[model samples]
Target: MFKSLWLQTAYSRDPYPALDQDVTCDICIIGGGLAGIANAYYLAKEGKDVILVEKDTILAGATGNSTGKLTAQHDFVYAKLLKQFGLDQAKLYYGVNEQAIEFARSFAKEGEIKAADSILYSQTKHGTELLRHEMRAYETLGIPGELGKNSELPIHIDATLTMPNESQIHPVRFGQHLAQLAVEAGARIYEHSDVVLMDLKKRLLAMKSGHEIQFTELILCTHYPIEALRGLQVMKLAVDRSYIVAAEGNMPLQGQYISVDSPKRSIRTAQFDDKTFFLLSGESHTAGAESNTEVHYKRLNTDVQELYHLDTLTNRWSAQDPQTPDLIPYAGIISSSMPYVYLSTGNRKWGLSNSLANARIISDLIVGRDNNASQLYAPDRTGFGSFLLQALKISGLVVTEFTGGHLTRTNAPICTHMGCRTRWNEGDETWDCPCHGSRFRKDGSVLEGPATKPLNLK
Candidate 1:
């Protein structure tokens, strides 16, 4: 369940129910967040019968908790993308995200949804040098951006890079609108319909309430897929948890800002009624395995107080995002063995951008349209350096959980989704809920619940 403050806010006011009865559709989407809804929206428009099932309500996942920064700028990612995957692949990645942003902007513009909020993009003093490097990379790709020493912000930073076309919006509202659009386009959405078992061989999904859905094609849009298919998604993608605090202030933070430093803080503003609010987000760490989430919250509050003299802490929430080893999202058909099953995950924290882009590419693949973005985001594609690095990191974490001090003395035993023992969290007292905060009690009752149910003890 979400915290008290967030639950009381505007975003949490509406809730959708889960799938209760057996049904069939042309496409079954598991997960009601942006990716699932956007995919459904497009597919339904194309006259495909789609059914979207969500464990909880729509946008109840990270989408609701997102800062909703809709931008192609993915935190100094271009340079790394160019170096690791080549310039062509990097350009495709950027182009897809940019197109996604444009899609959102157009959707808002056409009054198909509410207006997307625009935000001035700027970076901190620490990121100035990185921005210069990024600008050069962009120039190499013939993309235009600018450097700025001044901004609309009250706080002072050495220099910043502004991307004028970037935007933001209330993600929950956007999701609701997309859901309505999907339904109007002949797609059915089932909430509270948790998929407990997936029979890949039979192409069947077993819901928690004993209902089953059969589909010719399946899309695992659920932040984390329950079924461990080929390539071991649980091990391939690492989970990161981040925190945010929203409060009313003297004057709101003028732009969307991301830090270059670790525990990367993000600053932005929103308006509620006649009051302007500042949202401070950061305090990121590995999910369910963090040392001091409360301390991080306090630090965020402290930063807000020191920076803006705002004291009314209105809302606070946490989100978990799947981070790939190389920082690019894995999108497309899972593999040849599961050709009918498509997956979109490992978006890091850029869900707003990547989710839309994923929908476009995945839809294109499903419809048999030629799309270069699909090839760029393929799951099975791998290279030497990235493969070795992923192997080393996942193996090291597995080893440490077994041999290290973190897991040995935990009050409750820890375990990863792949059945590996996890490190215990003393503070949270819920097994540190490793493998993306799917927490359980000492007796194995769900507590945190990103994981629909408790670990299967073998």
Candidate 2:
């Protein structure tokens, strides 16, 4: 039940070996998901010496478990972005994401990419108002979109905003293809190479397997930065977990659909093994905030059975996304002082397009090309009032977590990222940190970070 539908595909690849000895490269990418793979693809093609390392198999992380919707219509975001970033920047944001979709089309294999209109519908009055505002933003931005009163979905709706030129893809398969292209272009990729320590001053990465990587440039695409940077990154980002389930059904929608109302729903369909599976996803919560995570899956199951009468569930999985204070990603050089280090994080659950955008921004910076988005997504961009409010909210969460962590008298080990106590997640069977979203397996090895060290369980 916890399997990912994308990982169930017949796509396969031979495992890359771990680093056997100390090595050196011009650039080292610290994760093997879409961002890292895409970055390596661009850089290596331009003749840069690149090496990518992953703690697990390629696409076995959030990329593999993603819902795979590739579109610029990130649910009612245009209106908010228009207000926050102004007209020109808002237009650029939409343009870059659209270009990202085209980037995938450039190399996508047949059947791996599918054309679909992305529809955002609303069942409530407030949601309908949001759609109306978003449609105006779309027009102002010169994006191709339309507002309507109806959709193909079985559920009732007050209004629908349909955006054309959107797409969906088998994300894992496409990522695997990107990895192959990167390797063919002279990028080295390694699997099972868990980086447990980093020496920023020495430009060295130490692996748990006792091998080391020395690099001139480094990119951390590990979803969360391995280092807290004095809690600056953690302060600007919050981790969200969302559940997804694939059920046996006919294709119910010609385009992907998401709701703007409460209990937001995301719907899309895929064809594989001569069968169509409807992927239903929603019920997002902050990671480690819920004690019994199984309830989320159960709720989705109940809703699907009631709505579509889809009694057979084929696969279920969940993914954690790093959300930013301003909803824009943190990309490009980490700081003006440390120009050699780059990072891309905080996609806020829209990684498919954002990942490519990050790759382009970072690659352009490294190759000395002018990119307008560099300023838009810089890691140090701050001082907006709304962004400050969101950052303060995350800070409040941190303080509350610290106070609660000490009050809870349990034998559970403290999180290595911060001192927050670990909470057992029954659905995923991992110990999750509420403060900074580090996860560990039952035996207490690091499953995800900002926590590099395994639990000090005796």
Measured by lDDT, the strongest candidate is 2
Q: Which candidate gets the maximum TM-score versus the true structure?
A: 2
- Please give the lDDT score at residue 51 for candidate 1: 92
The residue-by-residue lDDT of candidate 1 on 94-210, one tens digit each, is 899989878887665221232322322334555677777777887777665676664555565666666555777667766677788788999998877777788988889998899
User: How much does candidate 2 score in TM-score?
Assistant: 0.97
Q: How many Å off is the CA of 332 in candidate 1?
A: 0.6
Instruction: For model 2, name the residue pairs that clash.
Output: none
lDDT of 2: 0.88
Q: Where does model 2 exceed 4 Å of error?
A: none
| Cα RMSD, each candidate | 3.4, 1.4
Worst 10-residue stretch by lDDT in candidate 1?
A: 111-120
Cα lDDT of model 2 by residue, 125-187, tens digit: 999888889999989999898899658777788999999869998999889998999999999
